[model samples]
Target: MISHTSISTVASIIQLSVAPVFLLAGIAGILNVLAARLARIVDRARSLEMDVPTADAEVQRAEIRELAILDRRMTMCHWAIGLCTFAALLVCVVVMVLFVAVLSALNFAVPVSLLFIGAMVSVTLGLLLFLGEVTIATRWVRVSEQFVLKGKPLYDR
Candidate 1:
């Protein structure tokens, strides 16, 4: 009993819902990049500390201070990225739910039903990405410990 206009309206709603999801995805991408850069900077600092002469205590202390700052910054970046990733995932879930609810309410055709299925798949992918980020972040502490406390190169045996 749903009219053509009602189906079109539902389609528009689906499109509107997509905007926030896309925005969150963009934010998540930026955060991912920031987190990567922070990690790299921390790694470089660790390597520099290793190469510095051991006899120069004052210089070594200064380098250690710098490394500590970089470590704190990297930790902050990791947390920020994690928070943004979780937020993006929540936004994606909300959009998917809204899309499915609207399409079902309007009793749309096969294509709209397929679109809802696709949205669910997208939600699943988002959740996977979020989980991956968390896993990487958890391992970061181990990586930092190896580089700083153990003074081991990342690729060393």
Candidate 2:
């Protein structure tokens, strides 16, 4: 049986954990987006690879350039995912430390604060990496460039 004091402590910990739980939710959302982007990139690369044998020289050259860009963006996205995952893990640690400190009457103020700060920095870096990947994606050849059947050159109509 849990004592009233223990119940109160647990309640307080739950309350404190709310913010980190929300952070975890946001990280999960980021992970979802990164994962979907990665899947699409990989799928496109594989499809292009399959068609390479039959592609004309110009199309093959364009595909090669696109593949290289995709590879770079893929690497950046992977780094973003890793850093965000680390941030989420740190948030989990912060929550656990908060509970432990509260229940044991220990002063973990510095550790908790530092962990939260590190998590924030990690999240920031991860977001920057994601931004870099997305910005580079604009240079990828578009459908307009590929078809180019009835457009006024697309550069200076």
Candidate 3:
């Protein structure tokens, strides 16, 4: 029973919602790439430690410092991604609310309510994943710091 104009309005609202979702997806992809690079850096640091002579203390220290810098950069990237993800999620919530409002106004027979609920759940899951990544990056940074300052091996207890 909804008029054509109402349906078009709903479509427009949904279209507007896509921008934030796409932005978040892009940010997430960047973070994933950064995480992989950090893993590689950790592996290279380990390899360097094994190859370096213990008597060459200055060289060993320099390598450790470099690794620590990489870790800090990774942590910063992780936090930035986490913040972007959180903002995108907030935008998603607003979009979902607008969607529901438009659907109700149209009085469409379709169960668009379920779609709105699903969007909310998906955003929640995304937030949780971002938080988990942040936690991991923070631990990695801490380990790198210990290695640089105390001569401890990475991941040491």
Candidate 4:
């Protein structure tokens, strides 16, 4: 039989775990976005591969360059996803440690704090990698470049 005090302690632990749970949700969302970006990058690379063989030399060169950039973008997105997942795992461990410490009547402050700090650092690095991937995507490829003809507007009046 659990005492009222034990119930209250469990309630307190749940309350303390709420913030980390929210953080996990946010990490999952970021992971989804990163995975989508990676998929798109893969698709684009595949298309470029198919187009390369029949393209003119100049166009093939450009496609190769774009493929290289896409590769970098894919790498960055992969790293971001990995780091965010690790952060989410760390958060889970932190929450578990909190519950274990409370139930076992042990002091786990240092470990929990360290795990939380690691989670923050991992998430921060993941976000930075995401930003880098986005930057490469926007900087290396201009949408208008696709619409232009040989030194002229795609559609002139």
Backbone Cα, N, C clashes tallied per candidate: 0, 0, 0, 0
lDDT of 2 by residue, 14-67 (tens): 999999999999999998998898898889889888887899999999888888
Candidate order (lDDT): 4, 2, 1, 3
- TM-score, structure 4 vs. true: 0.91
Measured by TM-score, how close is model 3 to the native structure?
A: 0.48
RMSD (Cα, Å) for all candidates, in order, is 11.7, 3.8, 10.6, 3.4
Candidate numbers sorted by TM-score from highest down? 4, 2, 1, 3
Which ranges of candidate 3 are over 4 A from the true structure? Answer: 1-6, 49-55, 104-157
Best by TM-score: 4
What is residue 149's positional error in candidate 4, in angstroms? Answer: 15
Q: CA lDDT of each candidate?
A: 0.63, 0.90, 0.61, 0.96
Number of the predicted model whose lDDT against the real structure is largest: 4
Tell me how candidate 2 scores on lDDT: 0.90
Model 4 lowest lDDT segment of ten: 148-157
Instruction: Single out the weakest 10-residue window by summed lDDT for candidate 3.
Output: 108-117
Show the lowest summed lDDT stretch of 10 residues, model 1. 107-116
**Tens-place lDDT digits, model 1, residues 9-89:** 788887877777676677667666766766786787778678566638788777776677666666655665565665566
Better of 1 and 4 by lDDT: 4
* Candidate 2: 10-residue stretch with minimal lDDT: 140-149
